[model samples]
Target: MIKLKRNDKIGLVFFLAFIISMSLVWLFEERFDQEQWRSNPGKRYKMAKNIIEQDLLDNKSKEEVIQILGEPVTAEFSDNNILIYQLGTPPSFFDEEPQELIIVLKDSKVIHVSVNQEE
Candidate 1:
């Protein structure tokens, strides 16, 4: 049997630890849930990735978007057709800026959706 050197063994342990930590993080990640999204504002960031990637709001009417995501934080302005939904601050070791779900509307229909830091 081939024996590993002390440094090699230490490196292997560190690598295994890293892999295990990443696996745990992935397994515990939150998925998109309509009820959860509506009820849990602080956890919205956990599911925002899924909503954006799936294009759930693509081409949806403003009213339909309200029904799905509830009333936006900002009122509809005549100058700009955009909606902002607060996603709250993500859980982190360091203080991070709160996030927002920005939905751009054109002709009363959703055209773009993105998550960005609060300004």
Candidate 2:
């Protein structure tokens, strides 16, 4: 076997560490993003409103949402046929527009969820 220079050995260790650390982060990153997404109710509302107003329902499946909401309003086809379901209508205050909860779905499952806020 050929001998590696000291710096080369260090670089190899760093590269391996980076690969391993990033792999772990990638595995747990979803939980981190979802943690706050669930605690904040206002965010969930806005997300739902966006799904309906902006026509992002295509990102999720209708049947999946039906299981959650028990029905749907109207929606077009999703690019990958994933199911997106907004949980609740926005809570309005001071006669302002109501914020809604946004639910993101993938492969007929709820993957990401959040809410929208009005300023």
Candidate 2: tens digits of C-alpha lDDT, residues 4-106: 9999999999999999999997665322123344555334543353444444434445464554344332233655333333334444565455443445555
Q: Look at candidate 1 and give me any clashing residue pairs.
A: none
Which residues of candidate 1, in runs, are more than 4 Å off?
1-27, 93-95
TM-score of each: 0.72, 0.34
User: What's the lDDT for candidate 1?
Assistant: 0.90
lDDT of 1 by residue, 1-119 (tens): 98999999999999999999999988987778889989998889998898888899999998999899998889557755999999999977886999999999998898999999998
- Model 2 off-target regions past 4 Å? 31-63, 68-119
Model 1's C-alpha root-mean-square deviation from the true structure amounts to 3.8
Superposition error at 1 for model 1 (Å): 21
lDDT (0 to 1) per candidate: 0.90, 0.49
Tell me how far the alpha carbon of residue 51 in candidate 2 is from the true structure, in angstroms, after superposition.
Answer: 13
